[model samples]
Target: MVVVNVYAPNIYTNRRRLWDKFLSLCNSIEGIWLIIGDFNEVRVPEDRWNSVFDNNNALHFNNFIGAAGLLEYPMLGRKYTFLSGDGKKLSKIDRALVCSDFMTKWPNTSLRALERNISDHSPLILSSGASNYGPTPFRFFNSWIEIPGMVEAVNRGLNKQGNENFKDLLLG
Candidate 1:
């Protein structure tokens, strides 16, 4: 797996150049890849609030994602990841993009935004879902008997097993 962190420039020409160069690099690579960081750009109008929107810049940014065959996962916990000092302007600029191979390998990939205490940008977290611990243990709640099929389902399930303790506890 390859991870490439990028801090894109605010200048249109410079960011475009960077995108072209990065596209070339991706073409030559042969493995799962994850690219993330402050892209200094947004993919849609909804990504910005109380700020000017540039359709051309968004087009270029999305073109870069398409040309690189990068997949952007849905962000969780927040709508915007950046805020101005005045707390008036907000934008969702930081993101995580993965190649198809990486998405295939880690289908449960997700992105979340953390609190932005001091910095202008919120910290972004990318993870591949939960870690496996073990099988779940069974526990019965008395309140569950209020449900329609609770008693019958329990009786059917209990009948399939030979655990006398469970049978006694359930019956009592």
Candidate 2:
């Protein structure tokens, strides 16, 4: 797989130019492609919180993603990857986008947002391996409680007896 890590410019004009370049580059490549990094932009208004949404910017971003034929990989462990210093603004600016071929090769690939302790952005962990890795560490995110059936899911997980059984349940 071809993995491209990019840090896009904050300026809209510069970002547009860069996106064009990326499109050209993607066009020239063949095979699985994985694009990961801080895009400095959001595809939709829902991606940002406590901030003014820019419809124009969102349109540009969404167009780029569609043109690139990229799929936004589902993320776990956090609703947003970026947090302002004052903790007022939140957005998911960092993400992983994979082509369909890449998804076929690594069907179990996942992206996990690690704790953001020092930096403004959380570290993203990408795991593409198919090997069994025992039980996944149970992490309770307060935001998850808001989701319907999440509480029931947790209870069912906790109800499983024995370490092996619980591990198997989690892995399943």
Cα-based RMSD of the predictions, in order? 6.9, 13.0
Model 2 Cα RMSD, 1 decimal: 13.0
Candidate 2 runs further than 4 Å off: 132-172
Residue 36, candidate 1: Cα error in Å is 0.6
Report, for every candidate in turn, its global Cα lDDT versus the true structure: 0.88, 0.86
Worst 10 residues of 1 by lDDT: 163-172
**Residue 24 in model 1: shift from native, Å?**
0.5
Residue-wise lDDT of candidate 1 within 1-172, one digit each (tens)?
7799989998989999999998998899787889999999999999999999999999999998999999999999888999988999999999999999888988998899888987999899998899988545577688999999889877876676565554644443
The candidate maximizing lDDT is 1
Could you give candidate 2's per-residue lDDT for residues 1-172 as a string of tens digits?
A: 6889979998988888888888888899887888899998888888899998888888888888899999988899998999988999999899999898888888888999999998999999999867977667666679989999888877776666766644535533
TM of each candidate vs. truth: 0.76, 0.74
